[model samples]
Target: MVFSNLPQQQRELPEDGTTNLWGVSRLSEVHRVPVASLRPADSPRHQSEQAEHTHLLANSAQELPPIVVHRQSMQVVDGMHRVRAAELRGQSEIRARFFDGAPEDAFALAVRANTSHGLPLSLSERTAAAVRILTTHPHWSNRAIAAVAGLSAKTVAAQRRKLGPATQTTARIGRDGRVRPANSAEGRRLAGRLILESPGASLRAIAQKAGISPGTVRDVRARLLRGEDIVPLRHRLDENGRGGLNENRQSGERRPPVARLVAAPPPAPGRDEGGVSGIFPSLCRDPSLRLTENGRRLLRMLELHTLDGQGWQSVAQSVPAHRAQIVSELALECARQWQRFASQVRERAVAPVA
Candidate 1:
């Protein structure tokens, strides 16, 4: 299974103020779903790959992975070509995994899945997919969008530019699932003052207050202690993208790698309030959820994967290096499953229990 380009930490995001601990699966295990019952997926590829279909048709059914299906609409999310191949094989029932997510996200998932394995999406197809993502998620950083589209951040930036100023944003969500100001002189300045005001304050505390990373805060403190400028010498391009220093150097969008300096962090994507954990209690209390089997099932599903920040660290510490790869794969699979469930649930809000 493949996770989306966005970090799993922000799973089922841009809408649900929640990070997915886990999600309710419509079908807990792969089963034989009727071929006639499933719908054509909203694929990222321009068209079905005829060669891939032919290849799949030649393979034994046991050799192929189960096709992914949309629980609500019965649409395929990642395996339309497989579906075609199954149909050509004269199979009435095909093995399938269920994905419950919005139509748009389903498309993104399809792109990422296709990119991760199976036949490759052509360069043009990937470019088109990247453009669509930039349009829909204008606030997502180029790297985040590029991960899904399987393109370089540079290419993603170029596509964003072609989208014109209207689609350009002042802030963007980075690859690590952080929302940050495009330019960060203000944050650096603020960090410098915070360090001076409370010399004993922890780096995390200062970083949180200034909306910059702890790494950035540490650097700022180091500079202030030296009685030098808080801004890195390379970033002397300043707030206006020019002028304070280094006129001869490149000041364009792509700059040398340095600890990230963010302007100010924004609220979690599609949210103005608390993040996933913050909303967990309210969801637990909702009658529409607690009072019904469907809702309770979703809740229970979440409980199985519950791991807080410290819990994650403890688990990571305990895992043996020899088994780390298998653990990582399992962890990703869990995330992918929950992400699908969470997206679909959000798309429908609460399906009335009848």
Candidate 2:
């Protein structure tokens, strides 16, 4: 994001020490430029006062507040130099407005902000900003941000990879103020994939597959199924098994969500039905009942048009009893839905497109 605000047109200094610098300076950093760059009109007589005042303002007692500007869109028009100068002074924050300014406008502002009165950004800072902008605006390619920041595409890409997702925070310290890495989400996702693929897998095997410790896998699985955040354990155990990761926990862990289980598909065709060998009646009528193209073609061979109950029974005898029943039901449902859909389509096709 571009920093906002610039010294509004140079005006007479107010009688009071605090003028309408209106946070133009206080809200931002005092950008350092050649003393000669500033106009001589009402300029300080002493060169030392100019630099001293600039330095003092840059190092104010209070933190420089974020700048606020009113514009039609979030665009930086003026004050680019001041923003860059402050940033150079190790200032962490700068403010800018979002307005409907053209791309060229932003470029001019950036150039003027730096060359005219702004402190220049080091090579590293420009590279970081270029990379940061690409990540923040993914639709804009690395080339674009790099072009604006005056860095190469490869440099921008490298910086971005280091930055990772802008929204995701890196490792953070807990309430105890101890720093910790964020692995729970990855751990939980791995655990879920393992549970689906191998329900009977041991915890150790699962953890190995997930690339996390068994204890971590266990905790992640538990918290996920329980709809709780995976958190660090609160206490430690002693030699008596009184604390640590396991001592306080229960033996019988709760199961993961039942929805996580994988369901098995039905047996394929050519299998005996009810100890018989024939095509099922419902299979003859329902196209979807055929799992393969071969089974669909078999419908034409069955003489289903002329054969009623007896013919169907003969065909059904080819399949096992259990398989016959399942296939029959599936075929009937498929035929019913297909007929309904076909009817609707016919009606619509007969009507006007409008």
Candidate 3:
């Protein structure tokens, strides 16, 4: 009674059989289908485990009319698990139904029987399902046929693509700075005329003559030269890697990042002197001190005679009585000013807390 991947026809008995439902028979008398090449409940893994408990419904239970079959055998194309479960019960017999047909037809009919309720399939899943049915069984229902054709039953839509004729069009920049396409038949005709007649004319001249932008003229002319047959030059990719006119435009190539084009803010305008005002003359003249605020301030303070206009050396010579003390005090004053300027710049750059 055990079989492997039996089509529906092999699993059925003659329709005119003397066997009666009320007649008792050993469960082993029924045919067993081999589990190979069968997926149970859309899950292959769950079918591998043997269940410990088996339940059976009494024959006396009321039920709807049985599914009738016209042929001798009905294959177990689906529901392998249900069949196994029924066999596990200790009862000698189980309620069953049968269909009669060629093994292949029965297998296909079994699949179409819809014995189990399940979730709706996704688009990609439906496509795959359709492919399988079309490849394996062509005699199934239209539902199966369409599924194999990758049609969405709900939407009645197919993924097969259509390519239309390519056309020429003026490509102008819109007021918003994006590319604009021309549409009028007269306009496209005029553009095509100008292109075929004036071979040496630049895009700007062609656009001017056609009352469109130079960019648009260029686009239309290019498409025409490439021998596209449509009025509004549209580009789609075909299987052979050539341009095609289709409902959807070919995917555009990607561009690089925008951050690379910018230079780094000219190193923050190079604090004129050692600070914002450039009052520190020494720091202002030092090229190496441009990026570093601290270095600039140091150079500026050390050259304090130029910054204040009251020459430090001259002042010390004028009062020779404490020349050494005067130089030391002047140097200290310069250091203090530099610190104050540096702090002011830092404070301005740092944002205030909310």
Candidate 4:
């Protein structure tokens, strides 16, 4: 069976202030470089800044920021003004960091850095930068290029449409650094097929095979069992026949977005006192859960998550103010774990042997 990629642990952003947009790490630590050895310009701007601008920068009281230079070509990726100002001041050398990457990616990094700090690029200059980056990084999603070029994702998408076949691609690398399908409709069809043919397959196993999330895979199985479309109504292309990802969707997301919890069956129901509170007693009476070690382990795990309204309130109230953000994020992640757990339980209930 064919399967697509879903990493065990999604990549997280660094605290050191680096970003995924740069692609490759620096070739070496920051060090001084001879002013004469560097190329004059490879800036994101289309034209040189006015002489007064550089002259003013040369006279600034603050220290100048380091330049990012391509190690091989010895060309400046960013900081053309800084370099020129140094020369204006009669400084012999400048502090520099080296970039070891393809020339095209170096330009992408330059655009990103220029957008981040220093004098802002003009609207036209940023638009031009987006166009250039599209040619080089065609596989990057609209948001990724938008981030680098300081344009809105919509603006980048418009430019992408103008580029036509040059930028046409089925998969794109998002800002989080995970590559996913541009549209998910096709992946749902595949997930439906996988579920029908291999009813016993685990949700993660099928999710990887479908190029969709395990949550999505579980939805597909439930839809198949209930006689519904595997693809959601909103996901369908419109009358204009336009197809694209919904930026708000958690589909094709990661980087919990890719929960990998174990697949355990929801115990067969045998008794009930009623509502949500009755779920435990119902499962407790089932022989499948009562008889086996793994089944008993499943019961024990479920017991921990069976908190009532006040129980949850007490836990929420106990959180310290300083840890509010951290605890809230962790709570959301814990909820995702429960979601994956419930999804797998439903998929397993209808499994050939689950």
Which residue ranges in model 3 land beyond 4 Å of their true spot?
Answer: 1-74, 115-129, 137-151, 154-354
TM-score of 2: 0.23
lDDT (CA) for every model shown?
Answer: 0.67, 0.43, 0.39, 0.71
Question: Least accurate stretch of 10 residues (summed lDDT) in model 3?
Answer: 18-27
Estimate the overall C-alpha local distance difference test score of candidate 1.
Answer: 0.67
Q: Worst lDDT window (10 residues) for model 2?
A: 39-48
For residues 64-162, could you state the per-residue lDDT of candidate 3 as single tens digits?
Answer: 122222224333433343444544533333334444444444433333332111112345545544444433442233333342233544322132111
Instruction: Name model 4 segments beyond 4 Å from true.
Output: 1-18, 191-209, 213-354
**Residue-wise C-alpha lDDT for candidate 1, range 1-354, written one tens digit per residue:** 222233544222122211121122323478789999998877888876566555544464344667777788999887776777777778899888787766665666667767766667999999998888777778877877787777998899778767887567767777666787655667888887777578789999999898888999888877654435577664455444442333435544444544322212233444424654445555554434543457667666655444556666998999999999999999999889878977996878877766
Which has the greatest TM-score?
Answer: 4
Better of 3 and 4 by lDDT: 4
TM-scores for every candidate against the unseen true structure: 0.55, 0.23, 0.25, 0.56
**Ranking of models by TM-score:** 4, 1, 3, 2
lDDT of 4 by residue, 226-253 (tens): 4455667556554344543463243453
Q: Model 1, residue 315: what's the lDDT?
A: 80
lDDT-best of 1 and 3 = 1
Give the Cα-based TM-score of candidate 1 against the true structure: 0.55
Clashes of 2: 29
